[model samples]
Target: MKKEIKKIVSYSSFLALILMSVLACSSSEDSSSEEADSDDGEEAVTELHAAFAAFNSDAVTAILSDDGTEVYIETTGYPDHTSVYWETDNALYIDEPDVSKTTQDTYIGGGQGEAASFTVDATPDLTGATVATQLNTIGIAVSGASIFNDQEGAGDLDQAAGSLDWAGAHKGPGVYHYHLEPTPITSDDDSLVGILLDGVFIYGRQCNYTGGTPTDLDASGGHTSVTQYTDGVEEYHYHIINEVYAAGNYAYQPAYVLFAGPFQGY
Candidate 1:
């Protein structure tokens, strides 16, 4: 009897050990599955809402090239512009404007002024014109209908004109952002120019800048600083700095680019 009882106790102990091992393995599998599902859910959300993001990732990819350089026109006070080159590393190479040069005649007194006068005459019956035409006339009026002498026949400016449709499509009501001059995205074959919807501008993997800090100009012109982080670097958006500061000497700091997608940090 004693021998039979001992045999039975030993067998029971072995079966208990096997049961514990099975439970442990099952718990680990459940935890791992939950983690994977969480990751997948986050990716789905990013894919769904990417279009509403302030910067268009696809557009940036299309325009910026490897080892390319870009120039940003600063219209803060004196309309000073700066050029930055992206080699192996991002670097700023400032280009100062020559004040001695007079405005070119070809760009000045073109059909733009006459067109503005015609718009004013036609504004009496605004109800008759289409919304697009009325909006174009309003843009001309806000810009003072002045002919830009230095801007005539420039391919850069022409590209900006082409991008107006894209800008208008993405623009929000009361959000006023404009690029009077061409923003040259220098590529080897052909250069591209486009206006940014937000105050911020991102030039590929190399560098990014803002004309002024983010502001809500729709209601009232107020300032908000946007900080972006990407690839282990943070950058601030540049915008029209204070007019009191010298044009070329405006303050700028490195900020980050907020990228949303599968490669969030990249």
Candidate 2:
């Protein structure tokens, strides 16, 4: 009887040890799971210019650098796609008669562009709509081309349209640029085109014309909405009004101005 009692007590002790071991392992696994969950809860991160590196055109070699407070983009002021502006002797030059500004007696610039850099506030704020001071390079296109505001020389955009390439780009060999949407580098209008001087994004007409009709836009043709890079989080941005409408009625009326009024952001 004494031996049986001792054996039973030893068996109970072994079971208690097994339960403690199992509980300890379970506690350790739960702690590890909690650690992983904490790591995932950090934050959603996006960049101001980091995304532009992907759209680089062959014309410009764009380098991007960001220090927590600011972003600096240094790029060659030319496009990766073929253009009439390229030197006729260069292989990338496309001398098509159908090119927007082609005359047998005349062609646009026949040379490559020099390098230029742009800097702007990393987190620019919209104080109000402000007229662009000059025909500044208001933005940079993914094609590595500069984006001039609504004016060229002293005239409005109408005067400059004649010289643009099919991709809406033109220049004098020194500083090539785009006055309208540069579709050469982007997949479509909704794709991210580039960042403006004030660190705002510029999109083609499709962003506001999702339903084949133009959405109501503010004075600068800008509104806060979700973007591809923003990943569904909303951001303030501008859209180019470059689509021409047919004589017949359409789902959405197109915008006529190139940029439409002034920039709401600085």
Per-model lDDT: 0.24, 0.61
Angstrom error at residue 212, model 2: 5.3
lDDT per residue, candidate 1, 1-266, as tens digits? 99999999989988988888888888888888888876533221111111113322322222211222221111111111122211112232232232111122211122122222121110011122222111221221111221121121233222323222111110112112222322222211111122222212222222222433333321111122333333334422222211221123111211111111111110
Name the lDDT of candidate 1.
Answer: 0.24
TM-score of each: 0.26, 0.65
Task: Write down the TM-score for model 2.
Answer: 0.65
Candidate 2 lDDT score relative to the true structure: 0.61
Clashing pairs in 2: 58-80, 59-80, 213-252
lDDT of 2 by residue, 69-184 (tens): 34565666657778777768777788645455533333234344346677655655576457653575667777777777667777766555556675666674346776655657
CA lDDT, candidate 2, residue 204? 68
Best by lDDT: 2
